[model samples]
Target: MKELHKTSFWESLMIQKRVIGALLMREIITRYGRNNIGFLWLFVEPLLMTLLMVLMWKFFRADQVSDLNIVAFAVTGYPMMMMWRNASGRAIGSISANISLLYHRNVRVLDTIFARMLLEIAGATIAQIVLMGVLIAIRWIEMPADVFYMLLAWLLMAVFAVGLGLVICAVSVKFEFFGKLWGTLSFVMMPISGTFFFVHSLPQQVQEYALKIPMVHGTEMFRAGYFGSSAVTYENPWYLILCNLVLLLFGLAMVSKFSKGVEPQ
Candidate 1:
């Protein structure tokens, strides 16, 4: 009877949700106090980033990519990748960075990690919506071809970001240089992830490699919903979703293991 009672899934969900919510609120306050712009920058930062990337691409790659819309390409691709990048990068050293808070017994390590993830997700989501809205208003990017699929892709990408964030956070707690390593890697990943150009426009061999990067698939899927038949072939939303799930489970397991002795030791 006790075992059966402990197996109540809904009860567990409620508990986790309550914990996550509390942490999220605290995170918001700590990260974004009473500034006038406050949470608005979350959206604005990404918008500016996408715009800059589009401008740079137009100046340099105007010839290689002439068919599809570059602004739409940047808006779709950069926001998705930026979400994961920002989440994971911020999460990487969060444990050690927030060690003062962790000293409080009520502050679980998972709570700290979760708080960071929520903060990043909130910022990323705001950015995405704001950019999409502006693009639609100006007729720069169209509404999604398949809104449902686009939403599904966003959900999976968020989950994937959390998973990767957890792993990076756990690792960074033990190794200082892992943080620097990620910075370099992120710089290298920008062009390869199809942030400015359409992957389907690549040669067949290059296309295969681009598809291997899950962000490419996520971006292409998102743009497909926006551009309909004009969008590139994402072709493997299921694959990206599966990869996210696997990464999430693996990350959680690793965090649990490494998190045991992370408190001020």
Candidate 2:
């Protein structure tokens, strides 16, 4: 009996893996289409946005928040912000968008959310790497001080984005108005997200309040890794992890409960 149960568990896991893979492929095709530049848009979209921001800052000769490279600063910060926005934005109303897929016995609400999240995260990560490489090759920015820590910070930021995405997805499904409200509210989050500036650049009290936002901690930590000792970060990795965990758990519970209540269209 025990052996049979274990075998069934592994088989179930494999099925889910395949299902998610299929869903990912389908999502890409649906969003990007079959043209030559179709899939390229995944990375290109974010890359162009980052490039525009970098050029804008460069043209303006924006005063450095720190002594960090302005190009590198924009490269790191904008893509990370896009990861959060893209993931959550795509996740919102994902179920309704892919409602037909729900007819399949193997498909689940979480699977749709995961597929979208994976696509957004993958695109953002690829854009960041390509942008950084180009900048370095052109001598526009120095190599990151700690490659491992830089990657770790990026990973943590991705996790937070995914958690927040899941929550947004579930909530939007429950309340239709949430989708529009969140779209407008996300813009408000940008200035405070530690994207355009560092937390330490703010006044002491404001810095304390800013660190409470998980994305700020992730951004500051990412800069700290990239710029080495010169970077000033008020990050608590543990706190960010805890917040992700709570959001993830709550999101999963909500999705599981509310998904069953969704009426087929």
Candidate 3:
């Protein structure tokens, strides 16, 4: 019985792996197409946006935010923001977009959401690495003080993104208006996301309030890794982890509940 159970577990794992892989391929093909740039667009799109932001900040706000390298700040902050937005945004309508795929016996709703989340995370991570490498080589930015901590914070942010994405996916499917609502809400979230500014730069009261947000903590943690003691980060990693865990559990429950009622189209 133990051997059989082990075999069954591995088989299920392999099946899920294959399903996610196939969905990723399909997602890339559908979104990017097989034309000139193709998959390269994944990295290029975010790179260009980061470059634009870097230029804007360097030229327009160089002295506005003192003691910070605008180019490095833009590269780190913007890509993280894009990761959160892109992952959750794509997940919002993932079910509806891939409704036909759900008709297949092996294709689950979570698979669709995971595929999009993974794709966005992968793309953003690649863009971040490449952009940071170039910036370091050009002497625009120094190497991070602690690469592991930086990656840890980024991973935490990605987890938070996935949890939020799953919840948004479940809710958007159940309520038609949620999709539109989230679009507006995401914009509202930007200023508070610790993307353009550091938490310590704000007033004490404002910093207290901003720490309530999980994304703020994640961003602070990442910045801490890069800026070392020079960066002021008001972060509670444990708090962020707890919140993400709760969100993930709720998201899974919601998805499982709604998925049962999803009819084939």
Measured by lDDT, the strongest candidate is 3
**Candidate order (TM-score):** 3, 2, 1
Error (Å) of candidate 1 at residue 10 is 5.6
Give lDDT tens digits, candidate 3, residues 72-92: 777778889889888998898
Model 2 lDDT, residue 155, Cα: 94
Candidate 2: Cα lDDT at 198: 83
C-alpha lDDT score of every prediction, in listed order: 0.76, 0.87, 0.88
Candidate 1 C-alpha error for residue 67, in Å: 2.6
Clashing pairs in 3: none
**Candidate 2 lDDT by residue in tens digits, 1-265:** 9999999999999999999999888888998999889988889998899889988987787745446678778877888999998898889877888888888889988898999999999999999999999989999889998999889889988888888998898888878899989988899999889998888788987887888888998888888888888777778889888988998899888888988887656
Query: For model 3, what is the alpha-carbon lDDT of residue 19?
Result: 98
- Roughly what TM-score does model 1 have, to 2 decimal places? 0.86
In order of appearance, the predictions have TM-scores of 0.86, 0.96, 0.97
* Poorest lDDT segment (10 consecutive residues) of candidate 1: 57-66
